[model samples]
Target: MVGTQHAARILVASNRGPVSYALGDDGELTSRRGGGGLVSGLSAIGPDAEAVWVCAALSDGDREAVRRGVGEDGVRMIAVERPVFEAAYNGIANSVLWFVHHLLYQTPLEPVFDEDFRGQWASYQAYNAAFADALAQEADRGAAVVVQDYHLSLVPAMLRERRPDLRIGHFTHTPWAPPDYFRLLPDDVAEEVLGGILGADRAGFLTRRWADAFAACCQTLLGATVTTTPAGPEVTWRGRTTRLGVHGLGADGDFLRERAHRPDVAERITALRAETGAGRKLIVRVDRTELSKNIVRGLLAYRQLLTDRPEWRERVVHVAFAYPSRQDLPLYRDYTAEVARLAAAINEEYGTPGWDPVLLKVDDDFARSLAAYRLADVALVNPIRDGMNLVAKEVPVVSDHGVALVLSREAGAHAELGDDAISVNPYDIRATAAALHTALTLPDADRAARTKRLADASTALPPSRWFLEQLRELQG
Candidate 1:
């Protein structure tokens, strides 16, 4: 509403916005801005572009701000009712869609789509409708609207129905499931999801593998026609062709390097070095305790390294930052607890009078993570399936002495950095342990050269460039 004098020509729609509000005990509201690819991309376009970001009001303060008509310039927050939000977000999006896309469901036990699921699906539709309505109200005729991630898969189609003149684009941040895996959803549900995405003028993914998987799902489920062209793959459904493009999000190398050297990060680096002992090597991983991150398996691999290679017992330390995520879901709560318990078991088994082999911290501290990145001798990023593991690209850019990357083949970043990284199957603990050993023992010169190449590739399509490229293509 801040820029209500004129309609916005460009729009970005997502679940979370660039800023959030907090209500202090003094009954006052304070706003904190967030940083990410979308934020950077929007900034790169400048205010002259007249872009409006449409997002959900996710917190109590945010809801209050919306009720009060308090908002940032060029941002609109839709306050969906709490019950509907929970049903759509936690019930459907996180529990069902996330599990399907990430292949996290245990085949015989889960995905019972009963009456409860149907109700949640209704709420999900309502959530998408809310965003579509907001965007329809704010966008100018022929405005380019970009919708983000799985949470709003239905938004593009809903918006299209309301405003056919608008240019619509949908980008999926998670890996797209293959036809076989995606078919796990009920037939009608799967078809609806595919048709929803096909309503876009263009659909973007992080890698070619995911993009192809999306097309395969559309063809298999919706009888869509897919063809390859010099530009990219195109999917034709119901007499409309939607172009598919890959925009692999990369590390903000300049920001990471600059922030990693700041006074706060330096203090954390000194503290971590003191705790890790002077000559011991540091193996570092920073991730949310999301099931797809495979943190438990990563810890088990570290344990295997200690058991198989005794020479590394006192010479190496594993520094893990497994921050909490989605604790509202019982599955994620259990996963977070398991990560903590396993870390304790390893430390209890390996700690000596002066050496703690595993230093585990569950707090979410960005400065500390940057410090660990700068100090890492071997960076571990072993996600089961990821759209793109930016940590695999980030550590190399910030490492003070150059770190060897132990990456998983399943990660989307592997498509870009596999040649330089020590790749392993995420499910094979022994192989991952071996990869870690190989990373640790890599020759200093070789490691430095690989790190340099990784840094270059990681920054090739930075956030701003990635966003601008997608906008340009969608505009065309």
Candidate 2:
């Protein structure tokens, strides 16, 4: 156990850690480092920062590592019971909360908060309690703790109750549903979720729009008093105030530019160019097949483009990378299949002897994605709702020849990138199709200029700085 002897002055809590372990055939665990805002932020703070990352044991190897007390320095992995973790993580977080936030639920036949849901809710509570207990044990007096995403929404309050001396912050990486949409959760559950987040000293979002939506929910449901400040908004409930701040996470431009030029990525670029054919313009979209990504609608819009504009036939190819996400949930698995089905349909309808209208890859390949970014003439990023679509930011940074961005207004990235992008309504397939056409036809100089501006906006708040700023704000 990482006890008081290793108490941390700074702490980060999330469902996933910066490193994961895989058990080899020989029974040795191989550790793989992860990359994201949190990992980059922690690394930027340096090794001697006295920071500890409290995360769950997400895999069998992770559980085994917990048993063996084998982990990277400044990391504490809690081995929650498998059933409990699943019920909370998949059953509630991914299945319930994700659907609610993203507005992915079908109104006629879903979200029945029955006995099964109650059981899952209990597990969710236990899951959060485990994290809260672990964080309370590891935090030093007045330590600053940042909890990540919806998976740990309840942790801030739970931890606050346990260690009032600690300064805790909660950042939601998903969109905050509008008050009406948010109330879809059972009355008690809605209040509980809002109250849990309000428990933080600071609650952070990816955009001002989402932050406002959160405040509206608190005001409408919890009767929290909200006030505007120079920094941002503050929601006070039960005589405790939680300040809300917006931090739009940006692309690691230096990393993407350097990594995109690697020999491996170059090889992929060549291969993709060859597969796409000579003199053919490329439209690229890279995304996890999360339901909210609106991959199907994007494909439908592309099909519309082919139907409406025959002149683009054999002249343009859409390179789509729809990697699987949350396959443990049946809904996600079905969405992935639907994506595949539609991609195949587009090819069948528009493909020719020399031209394949859409080149679809379901497997995840970072090198390939970077290659696509470099080769894209148009970058399609149409999400139903996103906290911030990093793909929208990254393509511009990595594009060798600047790519025109067809962005969705619903994405959090739209707040920053909309002015320079050909913004479209995600649900409007015809409008998105028109936007893609406009992007494809944009003059070279115009596209290049827009891309440069987007690249700048996208890197305005890099991952390390984003994390540090939040940490600083929490400490203050």
| C-alpha lDDT values of all predictions | 0.94, 0.93
Q: Who wins the lDDT comparison?
A: 1
Which whole-number lDDT from 0 to 100 does residue 359 have in model 2?
96
RMSD of each: 0.9, 1.0
What is the lDDT for 440 in model 1?
95
User: Which residue ranges in model 2 land beyond 4 Å of their true spot?
Assistant: 3-6
Cα lDDT, model 1, residue 1 = 49
lDDT by residue for model 2 over 362-385, one digit each (tens)?
A: 889999999999999999999999
Scored by lDDT, model 2 comes in at 0.93
Q: After superposition, which runs of candidate 1 have C-alpha atoms over 4 Å from their true positions?
A: 1-6
TM-scores for all candidates: the values are: 0.99, 0.99
Per model, how many backbone clashes are there?
Answer: 0, 0
The TM-score of candidate 1 is 0.99
Error of 2 at 364 (Å): 0.7
